[model samples]
Target: MFQNPSNEAIASILKNAKTIAVVGLSDDPSRESYAVSAEMQRRGYKIIPVNPNVQEVLGERAVASLADLPEPVDIVNIFRRSEALPDVVREAVNTSAPVIWAQQGIYNEEAADIARAHGKTMVMDRCIMVMHSLFVRGA
Candidate 1:
């Protein structure tokens, strides 16, 4: 379920991924998580907002954590601080998401290593929306 995506593989993931669970999602439209999730939703991907404080986002019910998601998630996009990486990685492992995407400016070598060790597709310090536009969506 998990494998490192080469440029071509990344292209494939973007082409086929149907759902994304966005951790650290915020109600504030200005937040990076919200913006990216909104973009992805507009692009036709289901964006599940994972956050404790928010009850809803983008008209969808918000999940408090990844583990609480009722269905399989193809990708887990994280917007948390780097210091929180380990716990997030553990959750990603538990959730069995095929891809774990650490948003732009968010990176932790230890977490990336753990994710890779678990055979997860890990994309650190990158923006999925940007990558999708550049490599697949042709924005």
Candidate 2:
């Protein structure tokens, strides 16, 4: 079961993060991943697209996997299904990222355990764009 994430923690992650590795980020403008990432980019966050199927997204080079990122990302924003999160979390544990966020309607306790064990701030079942609008600014 997933407990609610702390507002302060979510706020801290959003407030401090700059480069975000959007795993499963879609190039389609209609997708939530695209909309969320676009808004974040518009807010000045460097959006790193981590989709293997696409060469690039939103003008940024898309990496195939978390290990392919050229540098460490401040946040790993995943749009994959809850069942797929364990694999992504396993990959993310190898990185030095400070935060790992699963978009709304996605959460896996086991995966969250892995992230928490690795000292990452796990924010699940919450929309980053909504949180940013409500907590960070322009609410």
Candidate 3:
């Protein structure tokens, strides 16, 4: 059985995190990924878009992959489908980012295990924007 971290732990991560690499972030403003990432950006977190299909999103240049990031990020926020989590987690674990967060409706035990095994903080099936609003902004 897999469980998400406590609210306190989540708050801590949100508080300390300054940079987030949003995997699968779409260029289209209508997308959930774009909306969420935009909100996070408005809240002062640096948004790094990681989408091979787009050249840019929210004014930041999109990277083809996580490995393409010029610098280490604090969190690797994933917006990919549930079935793709394992592969994405595998890539995230290799990065310097300490946190691997899968957005709402995305969850995989294998992915969680891989992230945990790598000593990365794993957040599955949770909305980053909602969590930030709750834990950070106290909304």
Q: By summed lDDT, which 10 consecutive residues of candidate 3 come out lowest?
A: 130-139
The candidate, 1 or 2, that scores higher on lDDT is 2
Q: List the residue pairs that clash in candidate 1.
A: none
Give the residue spans of candidate 1 off by over 4 A. Answer: 1-4
Q: Lowest summed-lDDT stretch of 10 residues in model 1?
A: 1-10
Model 1 quality (TM-score): 0.93
Per lDDT, the best of the predicted structures is 3
The C-alpha RMSD of each candidate to the native structure, in angstroms, is 2.7, 1.2, 0.8
lDDT of 3 by residue, 1-139 (tens): 7899999999999999999999999999999999999999999999999999999899999999998998889999999999999999999999999999999999999999999899999999999999999988983
TM values, all candidates: 0.93, 0.95, 0.98
lDDT of 3 at 68: 98
lDDT of 1 at 63: 95
Residues 25-46 of candidate 1 have per-residue lDDT tens digits of: 9999988888889999999999
lDDT of each: 0.87, 0.90, 0.95
